[model samples]
Target: KRILYIMIALCLTSFVANYSMSSGAIASEKKDGEKVKKTTAKDPICGMEVQKDKSTKVEHNGKNYYFCSERCEETFKKEPSKYERKTKKGNEISDLSKE
Candidate 1:
């Protein structure tokens, strides 16, 4: 009778552990294939909207700059002052070379 009780307890413990682990795996797997949209900000280098959390960001002159891609980030790193204008509303990025 004592051995029967011990067997039942072990079986219940194994079942509980398996259920918890399987549920956790399913929850994580659901997000593994999903792409979440991040909070939006302006890409200073291109004057386009960017996802601040997802996009690459560079900090210069005590300010943060977001970029759409690594290329834009490299361009800004090369010349910080070139794209220092405000990028909001009707403000457009003027090619510094043209001006």
Candidate 2:
């Protein structure tokens, strides 16, 4: 009877530990998914905040681009020089252009 109780206790302890580990993994995955929640940026051409996934994007040179609309993306692609010129001025242009 003592041996049976010990075996049962060990089994229960093992089950509890496994359950805790699986729960922790699920919680971690939830946190990671939260981090992936929609990332947004302003369209350089139109000055509109756009969700990176929902909006059209163009990657030129080393930068990730976001667009308010397909129209803005097309305009940006057609005349990247125009946008590149403004970007060189950094946040100064971004701040001024926003207003």
Candidate 3:
């Protein structure tokens, strides 16, 4: 039926559009060609996803940490160790900026 064919075409178009958008979001990288996926990070101060390039950022202790707001940034600046990312394994993500 023509209606069935139209629905199929629409579905395919939607699939293609979504695929491209998802792929494009992950196509970003750092200056050293390290691929950083546009995924969620727990904002040090608020536990929100700090999206790639879309979230507000502050460079601290030689690594770039993302924040949900200026208030969170100020909070982290005052006591960075308290706000630093900690792994579930009881380790901290190394901030190599000091090197």
Candidate 4:
């Protein structure tokens, strides 16, 4: 039937559009040919996954950390060692409700 054909065409179009969007989001290249992906880091203060480019950055002990908000960043700044220890032990701070 025509309706069935139309539905199939709609599904295919949706599939193609979604595929393009997701692939583009996951990876891209810089002008210098460096591959860039949507890299995410767990916020040491709030346990949120933050995009590195968008989040607040802090460097301590030669490592970089990201935060979801200014409050989280301030918290980490006050006691970098505490979070650094947690990170080293693979303890991710979950439970955003605490914030």
Alpha-carbon lDDT of model 1: 0.55
Best by TM-score: 4
Tell me which of candidates 2 and 3 scores higher on lDDT. 3
Error of 4 at 2 (Å): 60
The CA lDDT at 65 in model 3 is 77
- Which portions of model 3 show Cα errors greater than 4 Å? 1-36, 88-99
TM-score of 4: 0.51
lDDT of 2 by residue, 25-67 (tens): 3222436347433345556665554444455667776566776
For candidate 3, the 10 contiguous residues with the lowest summed lDDT are 90-99
lDDT of 1 by residue, 36-93 (tens): 3334455555555444545577877667787656666676899997777644654754
**Candidate 4, 1-97: lDDT as tens digits:** 9754554454345444444444344433564677655365667664555555556788776678876666677777898877754334567543222
Off by over 4 Å in 4: 1-38, 86-99
Please give each candidate's TM-score: 0.46, 0.47, 0.48, 0.51
Kindly indicate the candidate among 1 and 2 with the higher lDDT: 1
The global C-alpha lDDT for each of the candidates, from Candidate 1 onward, is: 0.55, 0.53, 0.55, 0.58
Q: What is the lDDT, from 0 to 100, of the residue 48 in candidate 3?
A: 45
Off by over 4 Å in 1: 1-38, 86-99
* Model 3, residue 83: C-alpha shift (Å): 1.3
Looking at candidate 4, the ten consecutive residues that score lowest on lDDT are 90-99
**What is residue 80's positional error in candidate 3, in angstroms?**
0.7
